[model samples]
Target: MKYALGPILYYWPKKQVEEFYQLAKASNADVIYMGETVCSKRRMLRNGQWLDLAKEVAQTGKQVVLSTMALIESPSELRNMQALVDNGDFIVEANDFSAIDLAKQAKVPFVCGPSVNIYNGSALKLLVKQGMQRWVMPVELGRDWLIRLLDECSNLGIREQFEVEVFAFGHLPLAYSARCFTAQSEGRTKDECETCCIKYPQGRPIVSQEQQRLFRLNGIQTLSNDCYDLINDQASMGGLVDVLRLSPIGIDTIEHLEAFRQQNDKDRPFPTPDTVNGYWHKLAGIRQSEDEA
Candidate 1:
């Protein structure tokens, strides 16, 4: 299976963002996804900048994909998505339905992002018909459900058309809101709020009353409280997933990528984390536990 470094979710300074990818190019990641995905207002790098970065990454022999914002709140964001699709140099990851429409209209083979809610065989077939060459399993969907979907595709005879990707590392992005929690926490209005998220580069951590990390706050996005360490599950997920995606969190993601590359067990026990996998199991969405394997 190949490895893909998902978009840099946090807002880093422009130079730092460029530097991170430079380091990533030397890493074991096979595919590189770039562009602003979380908050459009956090524009440390502009559309042209991302396109340029895509070109630079492509030079490193990594297939570069430009990603769209998950939540398009304005006309400008829509236009941005259009431009990303229009840019002929690389493929685009359609995060929203509108992005899918634009990519189809452009007649480009696109990747369906996790937020698109693709649930079954029919949906997968329809997406393939609409020009989706690859699909990312929704973050909350588990192995059992994924196996069922894959089996359905096999029975239906359309399994070869799409590559399945899984979010294997980093803090899972749980949900996003229209309201900016970072601003609210700082007693500022969403519109007028200074980009407070800039301070907490990886996002502000949310803790419970007992001082346990319960979640992470990134502007309007809520992430898992425990940093997911899935290096051990790499082998078990080998044949089922085509690409293992590691969403960028901090500067030190190279080690995580390397660990997965060197793993050996196909049904290896998952590495224990002090956070919840509730969202993945269709459970509480915040319950934490260690899988005994």
Candidate 2:
């Protein structure tokens, strides 16, 4: 399976974001997704900045895709999506339906983001009709369900026309809300509050009373505490998955990606407390069980 570097989900300094992508250009990745898919308030890199980065990365022979915000709460956000669709340089990953419309208007081939809630082959077919070239299955679905869906897609005759991508790594994006938790953490309301998420390079990790990591607080986004690791299943992944997405994290991401690239055994380096794949196995999302590594 091809490896894809997913859009950076955390808030990073402008220089740091630039440097990160520079380093990623040399990494063992085939596809690079650029753009701010999280909060609109986090503008470390604006449209021009992201496009410039995408241009630079594309030079390294990586297929670049511009990703839209998963939470588009304002008209301005819709306009931003329109701008990306109109750019006409790279493929657009439509995270929200508003972006899908924009892609349709632009007559551009688009990748369906995981947040779009495409569950069945019919919905997938509908999106394909709208010019979706690839679709990311939702995070909560598991192996058996995906096999069933793939079987259905085979029967439907349009399966060969679509690529299937999976969010194989990173903290799971559990939920999003109109309320901004980063602001709430600072004793401020979401509306009038200053953008405080800029301070936390990685979203604040919420820990249990016993100091066990529980969840991550990223503006309005809630993510699983454990880093979602799929290196163990890389070979098997090729059969069911077209691309494996490694979500951006603050610490040791390059190292993690390198390890994943070198690993061939499913149980090589055992995953640590900071990593888990319970959600992928259809078990409790936080369960930290593992096979012999």
Q: What is the lDDT of candidate 1?
A: 0.82
Model 2 per-residue lDDT at 162? 90
Q: What is the lDDT of residue 31 in candidate 2?
A: 85
Candidate 1 vs. true structure, TM-score: 0.92
The candidate that achieves the highest TM-score relative to the unseen native structure = 2
Give the TM-score of each candidate: 0.92, 0.93
In angstroms, the error of model 1 at 67 is 0.6
What's the CA RMSD of model 1 in angstroms? 2.3
Model 2 C-alpha lDDT versus the unseen true structure: 0.82
lDDT tens digits, residues 111-220, model 2? 99988888898888888899999888787776667888998988988788899988888988888888998789889999866777877766788888999988888888
- Once superposed on the true structure, which residue ranges of model 2 sit more than 4 Å away at CA? 207-212, 265-273, 291-293
